[model samples]
Target: MTPHEALDDLTRRGLLRSLKPLPDNRGRLVVAGETWLNFCSNDYLDLGHDPALVAASVRAVEDLGCSAAGSRLVSGHLDLHAEFEAKAAAFLGFEAALLFGSGFLANLGAVPALAGEKATIFCDRLNHASLIDGIRMSGMKWHRYRHNDPAHLDELLTKHPAEAGETRLVITDSIFSMDGDAAPLAAVAEAARRHGALLLVDESHAIGVMGPSSKGLCAAFGLKPDAITCGMGKAFGGYGGFVATSATLAALIVNRARSFIYSTGLPPACVGAGIAALDRFAETRGALGDEAMALAKRMHGLLAEAGFEMPPFASPILPVMVGDNHLAQEFAARLAARRILCSAIRPPTVPPGTARLRLTVTRAHTGADLIAARDAFAAVARELGLLP
Candidate 1:
């Protein structure tokens, strides 16, 4: 289709995407020159604008310059990269960690690298797009079990046994981003163990916001996945991605993963901020995540009592399932008009009819902010005839 036709098509289908310049700080976003209470950010700990992180980034830019200069093996391997990786590995309870430009690239690289020739992959139906892309790029057939349904996964595993000269791999995202629900990692891990298959968990939305100590959901379940992929952009309040695994696996990715071998190294500024976030995460003792979850629960209760339906939420990421895309859009527009801005998520980010407003509450959101959200939601629900 021509560019004009594509634009028209998107507009016609309500699938058109638009950009809004919303500068964020302390759970508030400035959109269209008006400040709005932000419930759409992934900065769960409110550290994106943290002073320490800003200072660290500023210092790194002044001292190390911007780019890594080249790929790590080609003179970009600075002392700071090594230092950051070491710290990241230790912090995440892994033997080693290799940073990528983003979480998408990490999965896009790791999935295929782990897929041995003629491999049989078992993936979750609701895994992130990156994971699906990685599996597809591997050029191997994969079985997708029902979303977070371990019984279905076990059945699939039993039916699709590894044949001669084939390897078995199980991949999943620990936290389902759109639905704000967690995977049954304990059960999946057990299944993988029973089948003698390697497991890879993308903790993109889980790290720094889960686990007993906030290491990740894998740690909380006492499961040691063959590899854990994480993005530093969400709860970390920084930007970058990394895979934490054994030294051997790390070495293999360095040499084999095409995306990693080809892409330039991540910016030093992100590294500095990431290190600072990790340190702060250690200092807080997971209290930031705890507070965010507590507030989410409070909001869920408030909204439910007010007659607005909520998704089955296990984290700060909450979804108001509107079912219809236009209704989701309308709900968000109403909320935005009231100076409370949350995003309306639609296909293909979610299922065709599961359009929703993915409201993410952070620790920085005060009780008053939550009260505004609750009240605004009630008003919108009633106006939209969603309330009885």
Candidate 2:
């Protein structure tokens, strides 16, 4: 069958998915012309709609106009971008940083540029799609280890020690986005160091959520600056991504990373917003301590109490494992009907048979909100015969 026929087959099988439109109003996710309580968004801190961010964005447009207008190598580079990059690098304890328009592009740029033709990349199985794509783009032979299994990575390295001379690279997400679990970065780093391999971590989820001062997993684990590429949008509550590394590595990426070199720089508004967000993170760092973790723990407990099977993750990305795609979709739809929004994560986004309702808890949600969410899940599960 042709590719289009395969797509049609997927649609017929109720597997094809489309975007759900969201409205402009606060906390409103629009689906079928109705607003619902959003739980599927990655806006963990709920900073996406913060008044400060909005104000900063407005001021930026007023001062700097709309677009970056050209690629960074051409005329797109701006003083705002430099300031933001400098702040981000310093915050993350890196010598220098390079920004890309988006996290996806940053990965695409850095991964391939750092690892060349003869390099071999060892990647974790459950990493974000961007890292997987980056590894593929790197044109290096990549071996996938079982999710968070440092032993598998060690085995791969031991079996193929010959590839070490060709810039052996091991890559993983510091926090798995879908699972909401922290990676064992120390173990991974140890294995990398043991085999003289370089570690590349994408701390997209943990940059502003985990670690002291919202630095990231590398800081949490004391990994060197050269080990990380962070997405500013997720936890930074802003736009763009950066490769935070030593001066030499930063220079190399700036010189060779095509995505950063060729694409339009991040917008001045986004730069300002990012800078503001980073500053906010630093100022409010103490507040992120136990409250966020406590909230996540409470949600996990409530879900488990309601007999929902949650995956093992300490981060805010809580997954209620439903095991069946149709049921997962129905569960999400039922939640939506009740004005609580969640999305059914099915095949391609997650492995088959692991379809789940990926609910996120934020500082914005209260204890009562969590209870309501639990009640909703329980009601839906019981109604659907998923729970007794």
Candidate 3:
């Protein structure tokens, strides 16, 4: 079909979701707008619009100017980028790190670079699309084990022959984004170790929200991977993504990762802002970050009591399961009308019949906000005949 026809088809099928412009970051949705009470963002720490972050970015621009101008392999590597990389690696307890324009780029660059023809990439079934895409794009034998099931991973590893001289790399999201669930990393790591395989983790969701210093699930659980990819956009409240690993692995990716080599490096301002965010995250203990978790826990309890089927998780990502797609869509729309901006995540993003409201809590939300959201959900549920 032609591009115009394809666009029309998508709109007709309800697959096209339009964007409504926002004024500011009043909260998770938008501030100073007709809409309010945003539960749709990945801003777990509510630091996205933090004055400190804004000031830091401004300072970076004044101090470092605007752009990095080219790829890091060319002339794009700035001192600020180097500073952020070093600080990030140190904060996460890794030997070295490489920054990418985005978390998507980090996964896209790292996966294919690490996995080749002689490599088998074992991934969790519920990994983010970037990871799945990366592996598929790598031309490696992509294997999917059941989500969070180390036993399944072991079974896959055991069935493969060691004489093939192929290396096995196990990959998973430290926290599953859509389901709000964590992988069994300790078990998966152990299984990988037993089979002489390398383990790679994408801590896009768990990095700045979990652990003692928010060093991510690895530091929180003391399970370091062969490589760790995380986004600064979400909890770090900044822009860019990074991969922390050993110097050797770092060099290999720098040499071969197409996503990294082709894309222009992140702007100097963003790099400096990332450094500032890392500094703040380092100084701000996990205790301060725990506010989002507390709110999530509270939301979970209330939703459970109110008969909302929530996905099991130990993180701030909270899902309110609604079994039907149309019902989920209607509920989300009605809730938004009440100024509670939750999103209905449906199939292709999530599995069919498991449609949900993927509520992301942040430090910015107050008790009143939570109460308002609770009441709004209850109201919408009753109106939709979802709640008895």
Candidate 4:
């Protein structure tokens, strides 16, 4: 189709997406000259505006002068980056950790490195786009199991035909990005072991939010996967990504991952801020996580009582599924009109009929904020005819 026709189609079908600028964003979101109770940001720790983290970043800039200068293999490598990686590897219980510019780049680099051309990848159906893109780039054979279904993954691993020398990799997100559900990591590890495959997990949303002391899904299960990737941008309250693995495997990624090899390193300021953020999280691990979980439980209960249906929520992401796309947008609009901000996750992000308001709660939100949120949801549900 022509560009005009394609644009027209998207506009007519309510699929046209646009960026909404959120400036001076803290717990109260600033969007289009209005402040909103933001339930859309991934700043799970509310540290985006934390004074300590900001100070750390500024200190790094004063010392290191902003840029990393070149790719990590080149002159870009700095002592600050090395320090963070060492702390991260030790913190996550891994032999070594390699940093990347972003979580997207981490997956985009690591997936292809672990599953080269001759390997077969067993992927979770709901794995994020970056994982899928990396798998595609590898040119490796791939099979997607039903989301969070270990039995299906096991079946695929057992039945999928491959050559004798082909390696097998099982990849999934520890905490799904859109659905706010966690993959069955223990069961996945078991399946991978039985199938003689290496397990790769993306802990992007779980690293600093889930598990005791922010150790992630593997720690929660006490099962060490072959490789894991975590992002500093989410609950870490910083910017960057990391893949933790054996020292040998870490070496392999540095040598083979194209994205990492080609891109300049994340700024020194980001690394310093990341270390500070992690330190801050470790200071009060369970308290922050438990508080957020409690608030989310109340949110789920309130919405369910209001007639919204969903599976048991195990993460802070509370998706209020509204199956129709237009209705989902309307629900978001109504919430925004009430000074609440909940992003409408529509098709392409989710399945065609599974549009939702992807409401996320952070520790930064107060009890009053949550109560207001619950009331807003109830009002919107009633107006949308979503309530009984």
Candidate 5:
């Protein structure tokens, strides 16, 4: 199809996406000269605008300039990068960690590096698109197990048993982004062990919010997977990604992960900010995370009391299901009209017929903010015949 035709098709299907440039402000957004309570942000810890993180970033730019200059193998491997990696590894309970340009890049690089053509991967059906793309790039056979179902994963592994000397890998997300639910990590770990498969858990959503000391779900469960990967964009309130693993595996990824080898190192500003965020987490002992979770639970209660269907409270993410694509967009539009800024999540970000408003609660939000949001949601829902 032609570009215009594809655009037309997407518009008809309510799948077209566009970017809206808005000034950065934690927990609230200004659009068309009006302020709205923002529930679409991933900055769970609300540290993106923290003064300390900003100061650290500015210092790094002053010292090292903006860019990393080149790939790490060439010249871009800065001391700041090394420092952050060391700090992240220790914080996440790993022997070593390798940095990536972004979380998507981390998965694209790490997944293929760890699993090759001779490997077979068993993946959760509802994992993020990054993981799906990474598996495809690996050129390995893979099976999709039922979401969060360890029994299904084990059955798939047994059916696709690894050949002698062939690798087997099981991958999952610790906290699902849209559904706001957590995987049963211990059960999944047992399944991986039973099948002699290496486990890789993506903690992008859970890091700095869902585990003891903000270390992540794996740390909370005391299950050490082969590797734990995460993006700093969420709770770290910065940009970049990393994989924490054994020292030997880190070395292997450096040599084999094409995305890491070919891409430029993370910029100095992000590295500095990440380091500062880690220090903040260490100092506070995850008190901010506790606060955010509590706020999310409270928000969940408010919405539930208003008669909106909600997934069980897991992380700060709470999905208000709308089902139909156009209705979801209308719901978001109505919320925006009420000075609430929640995004309508639609396919292929979510499965078809599962469109929703992916509401998120952050440390920056207050009880009053949540109450206002709840009232807005209830009003919109009643108008749309979604609530009594």
Candidate 6:
């Protein structure tokens, strides 16, 4: 098919995506000259615009300029990079950590480096695209277990027993991004242990929000996987990704992960901002995440009472299910009209027929903001006959 035909097809299927440059003002956003209550951001702690983070970033730029200037192996490894990696390693209970340019690059490099063609991978069916791409890149034998179902994972492991001396690896996300649900970490960990498989948990959505001291869900469950990876963009409110692992594995990734070897090092500003965010987390002991979670629970209650189906409150993410693609778009549009900014989520980001409005609550939002959002959602539901 021609490019025009593909674009037309996407439009007809309600799957075409376009970007809108919405200027952020604190937690609110300006769209078409109107300020809207923004519920689409993943900044769970609302630190993206924090004064301390801004100041630290400015200071780093002043000291090191804008870019890292080379790959980590080729002079891009600044002292700030080493400092943040050490801090992150200790904070996340790992012996060492390696930084990547972004979360996507981290996964794209780490997954294959850790588990190559000689390995067998068992992945959660609903894992993020980055994980999926990494697994594909590894060229390894793989299986898709049922989402968050430890029993299914166990069965898959048993069914596809690893070859002699072949590595077995199991990967999952601690908290699913689109569905706003959590993996049963303890059970999954136990299964991986029983099968002697190395486990890698992506804690991107759970870091700084779901564990004691904000270490992550793995820490909250007291389950230590072989490695835990996270992107700084979410709770960290910066740009970068890292894997917290043993010193041995960190060395292996440094040698084997091509994405890490080829990509430029993370910029100085992001490194500084990340360090400042970690310091803030240390000072507050994850109080900001607690606040965001509380607000999410309150909003969930309001929507449940108003007769909208919702998943149990797990993290700051709340998926308002609207199965049809067109209906999901309409729901988001109605919310935007009411000055509440929530984005419509559709396949192939999610499975087909599972389109939704992926609403999130952050520390920047208040109880009043959630209440107003609830009221707007109710009104929109009534208009669309979504309420029973």
Predicted structure 5: lDDT: 0.92
Assess every candidate by TM-score: 0.96, 0.94, 0.95, 0.96, 0.98, 0.98
Candidate 2: regions farther than 4 A off: 2-4, 25-35, 163-165
Residue by residue across 101-173, what tens digits does model 6's lDDT show?
9988898898998995599999999999999999999999889999999999999999998798898999999
Clashes of each: 0, 0, 1, 0, 0, 0
Ten consecutive residues with minimal summed lDDT in candidate 1?
22-31
Off by over 4 Å in 1: 30-34
Between prediction 3 and prediction 4, the one with superior lDDT is 4
Across residues 1-388, which tens digit of lDDT does each residue of candidate 3 receive?
9988998876664455667676655464555546598887787887777778888889888976788889999998888888888998898888899999999999999998887557988899989999998898898887899889999999998987454778789999998999888888899999999998888999988877888888788887788899999987788787899999988889888998998999899887788778877877788877656777888888777777777766664887888887677788889999878888888887778876887888877887888888788888888888988788
Off by over 4 Å in 4: 30-34
Candidate 3: C-alpha RMSD after superposition: 1.9
* lDDT of residue 71 for candidate 5: 100
lDDT, candidate 2, 112-186, per-residue tens: 878865788899999889888888887788899999999999999999885435988899998888788888989
Global fold similarity of model 6 (TM-score): 0.98
lDDT of candidate 3 at residue 21, scale 0 to 100:
73
Of the pair 1 and 6, which is ahead by lDDT?
6
Judged by lDDT against the true structure, how good is candidate 2? 0.81
Model 1, span 1-388: residue lDDT tens:
9999999987776678899765655587666687689898889888889899999988888999999978877878777778889988998888999998899999998998888567989999999999999999999889999999989989999999888888799999998888889999999999999997889999988888878668889988988899999888899898999999999889988987877888888888988998898888788878877777789888888777777777666888888878888888899999988999898999999989888889888977889989999899889978988776
Clashing pairs in 5: none
Candidate 5: stretches off by over 4 Å: none
Per residue, candidate 5 scores C-alpha lDDT tens digits across 280-301 of 8888998988999999999999
- Candidate scoring better on TM-score of 4 and 6: 6
After superposition on all C-alphas, the RMSD of every candidate to the true structure, in Å, is 1.5, 2.0, 1.9, 1.5, 1.0, 1.0
The residue pairs in collision within model 1 are: none
